[model samples]
Target: MIFLDGIPISKWGLQIQQEHDHPAVPELRRKAMIIPGMDGEWDFGSESGPKPFNFPLGFIEYDKNEKQRRINEFVAFLLDPYGRPREMKLSFDYEQDKYYRVKIANGFTPRRIHGFAFFDLPLIASKPRKNFMVPSDEIVMESDIPILSDLLWDTGFSDRKITSPQSFEIINNGTVVILFSFQMEGSGDNVSFSANGKTMTFKNFANKSLEITDNYVVKVNGISDLTISNGIFLELLPGTNQITVSGSNLNLTISESLTYQYV
Candidate 1:
């Protein structure tokens, strides 16, 4: 099965035959140039470049009456409104929980032969990495402030969940470092999330939701809250990463999704 932007192409009556030059590793971008008299060229550094993907597909529908409508809808689904190329998530059933960020490359042209339609979809993966899915983890942290209790009245305030700062290990099986996002809910005067020795702290957090997006932007209740934030974004290394969530004078629940990548 083939999926583009989480939509199955087979749903449009198209069948994926074979893909040409689907790269396991992306193209290399090198910053080295040849020195005329040097025995070996001067080498600076190399990094992964954009990858191309070509999918040869065929339509299974034979009815000429419905072909035009279905083809139009299928084309519309693949292309953007203003013809601007945007990145779409592509995945296959064989590689579970993994996807590629790709955009339409070149143009889509379909040919008809014997009541069958065939086309080749060209895609470019700009990010040039496979994103692996990770499950979200949640932990509730206790506030440093103490609650008052009366012996005679015996309020149920003591039954509320009160947890302490939590420390956990996150394992990244990929070959490179991965940046992730996290969310915090409840109330607090200050909260901090730390991973791999880096910590990000938020101040004046009370009865609101806070999040660090995948792009390293901090948000509180869906608005940018960078003014009250400090420190670097947390990241996971290739192996195990130690993570800690702590808060002061507040009840907080932290949740995070740990997505890793492969070249």
Candidate 2:
């Protein structure tokens, strides 16, 4: 016996008594109709009495886009506090001997979403470190004055002495360009030189010289073609003795120093 939608149905049974005066009977598989939304209850025999059974209930088929749309709608309704819903209940059914059920409930609630986005990010800045200055020549005091050699020295030799100037050294093919800035004194012929073992000195030049009048100006390789501001910027071509600055009024004040090497 089986119950579906509150209706009772019974499975047909067979019996046989075979002998000289008896007949034979055949048995067949049982079939029952499962009504949707039925509370499971059935009876097989008097001794078995009323037995409780389960019904299988689930979404067996759906259109893909429609299913997704429905799910999204439900989610949106749940996130909105003032949204209204039509229905909410449990669905069940049965297949073979197994039973399945699906409980679905939804309501509205308040929720807010927030996040961040970035655009056109720049390169990270590195922390400032100590910069050293090294003089090209050894210093010997004469009347409390110091002198430097003609050769150039590594600026890294004097680290943590002062604030470093912004500079960059690059090579394109065989040409080398060193871009740097340095403060100039009123007398533009000589520049201040402070290095290891040397007191800051005023370097002077006779033939190759630079002169600063009322207007800031710069000279490279004895040519007065370049005019500079309060700070001097130089772009020199490759070659050790290629360029020189000489003048009576030329002077420079270096705040910091840096060093670079090529392999």
Candidate 3:
């Protein structure tokens, strides 16, 4: 798997397969010649015109036991128009006992490169960002009576003053959304979120139980719930900050301040 900017390319897969025993071992040696341009006519300097270009000549040997399983990996550093290296790999396996060699009869031809063109667009530079937000209308609430904040809404919270919500459940035919709510004031003086039975403290709030004091914490009153129905939901939980979401699903997060009300 090739990772580019934390994302992976999922479209590529193994293409070549090895061949078993064949009897043309002798005739192949005498007739074998690198076909010009991958697969085309062998220009043996016929009256047709000038001969086709060939690759640099080389040969490699491998153990007979490792013949069928090991492919000869060829990494070509194709020079661009400005003579910069563009990496690409080609792979295939051959019989071990056989004498395999390539004769360049001609120099390497830049035109032989696949997709090679005289005029091509230069590479573009851009920054990559995480797209976790889904549309709000697609979220579904699992609770019997969903509140306003619990309704589908485009919401984003940071790990700073306002701690992001916890786990969310997908609902409404797999539409994306999150459920979260916090009271504007009042509390045991602590605001936090729960994940897998563990409660993480939000440094911005004050907690009398732990004798910890913080001014940025917002005291939440009553049960507050928020739902993200369609887009991405990001969490800024202390020490466990992460983003949880699913394609076309419902996400739910319950604040610690409202745990007793829901229970």
The top-ranked prediction according to TM-score is: 1
Global lDDT of each model? 0.71, 0.26, 0.24
Candidate 1 structure, TM-score to reference: 0.75
TM-score versus the correct structure, for each prediction? 0.75, 0.18, 0.17
* Candidate scoring better on lDDT of 1 and 3: 1
1-263 in candidate 1: lDDT tens per residue? 77988788888888888654567778898989899989888899998889899888888567876877788887677678985777789988777567888888888778877679988989998888887643323111332211321111111111233256767766665667877576777787656768877887778666787777777788888998787688478788877677776776768666665555776
Point out the worst 10-residue segment of candidate 2 by lDDT.
121-130
**Candidate 2 structure lDDT:** 0.26
Error of 3 at 127 (Å): 14
Model 1, residue 96: what's the lDDT?
A: 51
Q: What lDDT score goes with residue 98 in model 2?
A: 15
Q: Which residue pairs come into collision in candidate 1?
A: 142-163
Provide the lDDT at 185 for model 3. Answer: 23
Ranking by TM-score: 1, 2, 3
Please give, for residues 117-146, the per-residue lDDT of candidate 3 as tens digits. Answer: 111111111111111212222232443222
Please report the TM-score between candidate 3 and the true structure.
0.17
